[model samples]
Target: MSPDFLLLYVNDPDASAGFYGKLLDRAPLDARPGFVMFKLDSGMRLGLWGTETVKPAPNAPGGFEIGWPVGSDADVDQMADDWAARGISIIQQPETMGFGRTFTALDPDGHRLRVYQPALRP
Candidate 1:
């Protein structure tokens, strides 16, 4: 089955929605006090839900990261600079990886955001 949505347990859904709205340069499809959702260009849904309202609360300070792929190395660098200018904490400086150029940043809730460009295949 195809993955349709990703839900992130956040301390405050409204605050997280505002942060993500600016970061993604788009408005949420559904924005409520306890929940928010954005429909990405790739047809995937990104959701934010109030942590305290959910049952069996998810572990805070999540360990996994969400990745965004760009078209080129320059795009990766540009995105890193943009995010930094927007006050998004840069956890890792832009650098080259085995796959391509990349950088890492953190969202307000400490979720890892990785931007990268894939290496060309032969």
Candidate 2:
């Protein structure tokens, strides 16, 4: 099955939603006391749910990164610059790795947000 929904456990749904809204430059599709949702331009759904309301307690944020593959190395660098200018926390500076050029940032809840350009094949 194709993965469509990506859910994140956040300390405060509204606050997290605000952060994402500003970064994505898109208003949330749904917002409530402990929940918010956004439909990304790619037709992917992103959900922010309050940690306290989760059925089972979550370990912590930042354990895994959400990888966003861009078209080129320049694209990755450009995005990194944009995010940095927007006041996003840049945990990892842009650099070329075995996979390609990449950079990482953190959300309000410390969730890893990475953008990369895949290394070209021979």
Candidate 3:
């Protein structure tokens, strides 16, 4: 089966939802005190759940990153700049790597968000 949804442990779902809403340029499809969700253009759903209330409490918020891919190296750079202007914390500047040009940023909950442009395959 394919995974179409991702759930993240957050200190505050509402707040995280707002951060993600602005970053993704989309509103949450469902939002409550302990949980919030967004539907993406790729048919994927992102869910933010309150850390204090999760059944199996998570050890931390940023064990993994949510990776985003863009069309071109310029697009990756553009997005990084846009997010920086929006007051988003950019922990890494855009740089070309083995995979492509990429940058890393942190969300309110310290979750790593990586935006990249893939290098051409052989």
On residues 60-93, what C-alpha lDDT tens digit does candidate 1 reach at each position? 7456588999999999999999999989999999
**Model 3 agreement with the true structure over 1-122: per-residue lDDT tens digits:** 99999998998888899899998898899988799999988999999999898988888876658999899999999999999999999999999999889999999999899999999999
Local error of candidate 1 at residue 6 (angstroms): 0.6
| All candidates in order of TM-score, best leading | 3, 1, 2
The candidate 1 region of ten consecutive residues with least summed lDDT is: 55-64
How many collisions per candidate? Answer: 0, 0, 0
Off by over 4 Å in 3: none
> What C-alpha lDDT does candidate 3 achieve relative to the native structure?
0.92
Say which prediction, candidate 1 or candidate 3, comes out ahead on lDDT.
3
Model with the higher lDDT, candidate 1 or 2? 2
- The model with the greater TM-score, 1 or 2, is 1
**Candidate 3 backbone collisions, by pair:** none
Give the TM-scores of the predictions, in the order they appear: 0.94, 0.92, 0.96
Candidate 3: deviation at residue 30, Å?
A: 0.8
Query: Can you write out model 2's per-residue Cα lDDT over 2-102, one digit (the tens) per residue?
Result: 99989998988998998999988899999988889999988999999898887788876546568888999999999999999989999999999998899
Question: Model 1's lDDT to the true fold?
Answer: 0.89
Question: What TM-score, to 2 decimals, does candidate 1 have?
Answer: 0.94
